[model samples]
Target: MTLDPQRLLRDLFDTAIAAAHPRQVLADQLPADRSGRAIVIGAGKAAAAMAQAIEEAWEGELSGLVVTRYGHGADCTRIEVVEAAHPVPDDAGERVARRVLELVSNLEESDRVIFLLSGGGSSLLALPAEGISLSDKQAINKALLRSGAHIGEMNCVRKHLSAIKGGRLAKACWPATVYTYAISDVPGDQATVIASGPTVADPTTSAQALEILARYGIEIPENVRAWLNDPRSETVKPGDPCLSRSHFQLIARPQQSLDAAAHRVRAAGLTPLILGDLEGEAREVAKVHAGIARQIALHGQPIEPPCVILSGGETTVTVRGNGRGGRNAEFLLGLTEALNGLPGVYALAGDTDGIDGSEDNAGALMTPDSLERAAACGVSAAERLADNDGYGFFAALDDLIVTGPTRTNVNDFRAILVLERHTDDH
Candidate 1:
């Protein structure tokens, strides 16, 4: 059967998104009704949908606020959904952060807080620590993004610089039972790292956060510096009593999305293989992907023709030049180069949130002839890689995938589709 590559790719993308949709998956996980007054709070691309899910599923007196990235808010009744900036914190984020903290502070022992945490929450819940301002945190966050630090490292600094993160929000709901439902966007699904672990115990220290800042050459304001120097400014540590009544539950994750995509691939008359979820360094990951594709093309050791290899996880990019790129773009450019016009191999890599490293494109698509097409358009794959402008290269070819506000983030989704070649073009 002849395969329509575009339609197949679109179907796979839809599958990934469907696997992580809060509206479809969140309701079943929440408690039917809490023993006390229930308040719903959340942050991330999926925050609004998560709120809607709670309102529809939980039969209780629910009241609270949820903050999501701009353009990701969903329609809801009891839960107040607020739109704010992401990747970088803004005034709207700061305002909501303060308000959420305030809401938690007045909770009584008979009350319960239902926290819906997800990716991008760290930036959305941006209440600067006592002496720090939102602008200060924003600057530091920007620097961290360009510094090649992984999400975990960046969030560590964020937790220390915020008044609402690092379990501080949970601390405020001291007398209340805080129940957290999270969508894991970080590698390993570390509870403490997801959304800066607003309701989980922090194993990091102010000194550690300060060290990360120092490594990135980020200058902290005098007040922030003083706070870091003082041991009393520490975030909630392991065994902190303030978190004694809290519970964290992971509702969705990258592996589940990858598995779902693989299932669809098999159902479409192809063998499905998962290439593992955890990965690092976009270029390196691309090289590994290319090697696997090459093996399938030549020896067919791992699998035969008509197969799809899937993977999910966050990858890092070391920014050495000024380029309109992101980790997803970098991976695509590298994959395109390695394929070198090989026949019948197509691949797609994208951030599940529909945004690739703050760029307009979710990710880029690479066909077997991607390099040739790029060359014909006067776009050199090697040069684009050097400039760190993969996004620009793909944009010029109109190969960038644009999905506005998916309202969910599960890190990156990668798929390589191999079809039987009628002719030996290799």
Candidate 2:
């Protein structure tokens, strides 16, 4: 192929982003104008963009508010967009979350409540339980981040500790027809796991939340501890009457984004082999992918050379040290080490939201000489991997990709390109 590799990669990334752009995917799924007012309330990296989409699409009277991470907000006409701290709760988040919950209250059956949920909403829509201050929630959220807990576990604790999450938001909508349009950021796209299922019934128990806290060695305040220990704090479970009229739809997902990227790769005169949506420890996933890519390059078993292997899903990082890296970076670092100068293999892994685990860099790139570059600089890839300093390694090499707030999130997108070795000419 005569295509410039960098340009081809950029095009594939853009295609993935376009497929998950809230304005494009969510607008088509909104409920048609009925004889009622449409009130939108949501939180996530894409909340503001989703709100903007609703404003542009809905013909009837539309008014609502949404919360998104700082720098992730888009301009909207009617829907008020609030910027909040992410992966941790802050006062800005608390205020906006309260507003969203209160906005849905007092809605009648004639009114329709539209919830635009997406990744990062758990923190964007923070509303600490009674007697639990935002500071407390913030502390716990930070602890969870470093605890190596999966998204599902983190959100379980989030649901029980918040006043607005779980099914409380749906309960606030009362007799209103509550419709939730979510962009899946969690594995399996479970409704209750996305944004802690603010408008959906939570099947998790408060006891389970407590267990997570204990597992992470997180100490809640006396009052907060008591609340979680009590059954009263448990989120509304399945069969709750409050959620009878609640409706949910998954508008965008990691798989769709991956497929979009794969399509673009194939269009660029390359084959596309998609790895199924995967999750777990970032380094382990990277090792597995490296093996597969090596196989493709040598044996061409699973896939032929001159192809790109694409995958998407969220990955977790077990923070063993105070490293300035996210899971995606960690994965790239591990992959680089595993490849060990394997020729003609290039890879890119990035979180679709433009941020990876609270870091500025979206992710890192790996080239065939990645290990050589590290060795030349006296950097031990093994040492960095052990310290969870993936970002530091890439930053030293200037190989980090920083895209600054894509305004949408569909979890992580990974691509490993294997090129065939050229034959020597006579």
Candidate 3:
């Protein structure tokens, strides 16, 4: 009960990250080595870590490549761990992705392909469809990101425009069994939506992808539009013979991480109310969380004080301004604004991958005096939030939580700590 709120919340966040680390979860989910060679191809924040785990556990010929966000790489002797751009595709990603296709292509039935997938895979595996340039994909990625499209919607568009995603990777390894190990960062953990389901059958269609783009008002070149209209652009669907040998399993998930954090909360003598892996617009979600925290603190209708409200999942942000912040930072800022300096309340929001929205920091923290502290520095929480500059806002107050790449991703982790009720107005 006497634990420092900051330390306690940070401890909880650490617990969640550890629970989802590839080293902790990938080893168990790895399928028994297939009869032949083991070729690992993966992309995401955890791809390199997953490869490292495979090298430690497997007793066979291991070879292949994986692409991760720059600085998220792990050392692997056999499997090459390549780093690339994320939230935006770059030449490095494109180069590595082509290499991955070559590695998996022409594989025999006796060979096994272990495809590691996690958050950021969509951008890390940046193979644009035929006639679609990398810059084109880059532009679309930026637009979708700024348009506030949910992961699924953005991925739907990505799937149709990618040569490697949406089951194409599995198809490239046709005749060879594909074993996909994934760390879930997407809401609902749908394999088809995670990293655009590189190795799993995509139920989403090209038209759906086009519709998503249109719904978001994303403009595309005529060539890209024509590709979507073509039948060949459609992703491999369920029951496709190419994916007959494909198998998938979730190695780690946001909910499991949240559950781990919740366990830590209980051990601290605080109640843990976990809001399931939820997703939506970042600020909007923060507003809802603030409401729950206020209710518990003021009315105690749902839970008493000295409790932590935990939630996890990916949230989107519609970029209306040129601001420097990720969704988690934005969420923290939004929560701070909504709380209106409610006493005895503290919160931390971060991404398990250690980076949020192109920012170096994992996220930021918000204490009861968060707004006041910002005000003292001539920083207006309302103004910063309006500018979508959560990183800048928190940076000024020195509240940004900077955890260099954790090398694993389970999406966003948020905690609202309500220690006591300060408002007496009923």
Question: Which residue runs of candidate 3 sit more than 4 Å off their true CA positions?
Answer: 33-36, 423-426
- Best of the candidates, lDDT: 3
Clashes of 2: 0
**Which regions of candidate 2 fall more than 4 Å away from where they truly are?**
34-36, 421-426
Residue 217 shift from truth in candidate 2, angstroms: 3.2
**Candidate 1 lDDT tens digits, 1-426:** 778876687679879988998987787887765444688888988999898888777765889999999888999989999999988999999999888988888778878889999999999888988778888888888888888788889988888888888888889999899899999998899999998998888899988888998987877778889978887668888898888899988999988888888888978889988876756789888999988888887768588887888888888888887889779999989989877878888988888899898788889898877888878899999988988899988988889999987888888988888886434436
lDDT of 1: 0.86
RMSD of 1: 1.8
Off by over 4 Å in 1: 34-36, 421-426
lDDT tens readout by residue for model 3, 390-421 = 99999999989999999999999999999987
Worst 10 residues of 1 by lDDT: 417-426
Per-candidate local distance difference test: 0.86, 0.86, 0.90
What are the C-alpha RMSDs, in order, of all predicted structures?
A: 1.8, 2.4, 1.3
Better of 1 and 3 by lDDT: 3
Model 1, C-alpha of 44: deviation from truth (Å): 0.9
Model 2, global lDDT? 0.86
Residues 276-315, candidate 2, lDDT per residue (tens digit)?
Answer: 6788889999999988987877778687788998988888
User: Of the candidates shown, which would achieve the greatest TM-score relative to the real structure?
Assistant: 3
